[model samples]
Target: MARAYNFAPGPAALPESVLKQAQADMLEWGDAGASIVEMSHRGPEFMAVATRAEADLRTLLAVPDEYAVLFLQGGATTQQALIALNFAAPGDTVDYVVSGHWGRTALRQLTPAVAVNVAASGEADGFRTIPARETWRLTPGAAYVHITANETIHGVEFRPAWGAPAPDTGDVPLFADFSSSIASEPIDISRYGLIYAGAQKNLGPVGLSVVVVRRDLLERAGQPRADIFNYASHLANDSMLNTPPTWNWYLAGLVFRWMLDQGGTSEFDRRSDEKAGLLYAAIDGSGGFYRNDVAHEVRSRMNVPFFLTDPALDADFLAGAREAGLIGLKGHRVLGGMRASIYNAMPVEGVRALVAYMQDFQQRRG
Candidate 1:
């Protein structure tokens, strides 16, 4: 079968060109006479891959010289625990703004380790809206403020429509999980103290993650931890504390290069807006045939979760979508609906195809 438009939340769709290059390199990478996965992390060939990946990522995100970038194994969930260990003392209070499922998960990762003050939460309203900024009760001397930049499952985000793309937290530094939305637009990296994303979504394949942190935060006297869990140690050893996921790193490097060639974040910002607008318009105009419960202003551009008016038709909808060259439209288990995750790799044509299919489905079934 031909390649279908993929919309899985993570381990999500990658650019076709990146996949083709990786396929060719899988047998032998450059003149190394070995597959990238078989090469030593300490070897010059893989070392170059690691170096170029980080450098290209820094350039892609416009990371400041004052910050350090680490390409680590695992996903954003691992970083959740490590961030607390690296940035907060044992008794320190940490402020968290819970907007969606991932935001709640972030709180669980740091419990008992730190004093967590949920500054704001939208759970009371079923996570359909973000609490107004003024209503947040922030801690005065908290360790840091944390927020999920975009919620992949709940279909909510800290969008410009809600207020600032990045919220203001006064003196406390801001930390964000941008797992699903990173590189979809131009971000003011200076405004954030730390930003993390699992590569599977927007960056590349699975088994790798990217963390951008302000250098000064690394010096904090955090709680006792092993050298492997220390962000500073990971940085000191150049993110090669142990055997790194070289294949994922190499694949991500190819993706970064593809993004640069496609005109970087500014261009993606435009494409994201175009694709999301098209999809949302179709949902809103469905005249109750389709519904997305998320508040309009805070709707996620990356993940669009909506429901068919009749729950019984859910299975049929997905089956038809797959038959029409559309896949990954099934919603997360927690939500029990449909979600379209249109990340950077998804073209506007894909969204267009999805919208057309939806219209046809409604005509046939509605």
Candidate 2:
């Protein structure tokens, strides 16, 4: 069967060329006579792969020298708890800007460790928009201010505005959960003290999460810890404290290389905007047949969720989309609509196809 244009949220889609290269090199990676997955994480061959992957990512994102990039596991969910464990002590307060389901989940993880002040929330608007920065009430002396840059389920993104003062936390650091938006745009690394994401969305497969933290934050973590959840330990050991996910790391390296060939993060930002524009245009031009709920300024460029005016047509629309070679158009159960996740691997052509299909579907159903 031919490859389908996949739009699943995470573990979503990868470049076909990368997949082909992996298949070709599965038996022996460069005369090593062993699959990359079979190699020891401490060995030299695998070390080279790990180093190159980190280097490529650093260059791609322009990560600064002050930041320590650690490839850890447990996905972004673990980081939700780990952030509280590492940064906020008992009785310390932290600020969380609630945008959507993921933000709520992240805050839920920290409830046992600290007082989480919801600085701002769009829940009153049904998670369709972001609260303006001016509306946030940040607590002074808080440990950190946390925000999910892009909420995958709600299709809302908080774009960093230039020339603005950082959020008021009174010596607190800024942390971002960039699981759905990493690599989709050029971010100001200096503005954030810590940034983490699960690699499944835009980087690699599951089982690996990337953590970018400033060196100063490591000092604040205090004492030596033995558990895998300890960020300081992972940083001290160069993210190989234990047996790492060798296969996922190898695949992530291929993705890094692919992104470089495709012109790095700036190019990615441009293409992402273009793809999103194409899809949003389809929804906007559909008259009353289709609608997107996200506020214009905060709409996600990676995940585009929309709904047919008639909710009863949801199943038929998804089935038709699949038959037309567009897979994973079904929205999350919580959202109960159609979501088209056009991540990094989704080509502009795929978006064009989806838009054309949307037009056809609208005309037929009208």
What overall lDDT goes with each candidate model? 0.93, 0.87
List the candidate 2 regions with Cα displacement exceeding 4 Å: 160-170, 222-226
Predicted structure with the largest TM-score when compared to the true one: 1
Report the C-alpha lDDT of model 2 over 240-320, residue by residue, as the tens digit: 888888899989999999999999988999999899999999998889799998988788998989999999999899899
lDDT of 1 by residue, 92-180 (tens): 99999999999989988884868999999999999999998899999998999999999999999898753337888888999999999
Q: In every candidate, how many clashes are there? A: 0, 0
Cα-based TM-score, every candidate: 0.98, 0.96
State model 1's lDDT: 0.93
Candidate 2 minimal-lDDT segment of 10 residues: 160-169
TM-score of 2: 0.96
RMSD of each: 1.0, 1.8
Candidate 2 residue pairs in clash (backbone atoms < 3 Å): none
Off by over 4 Å in 1: 161-164
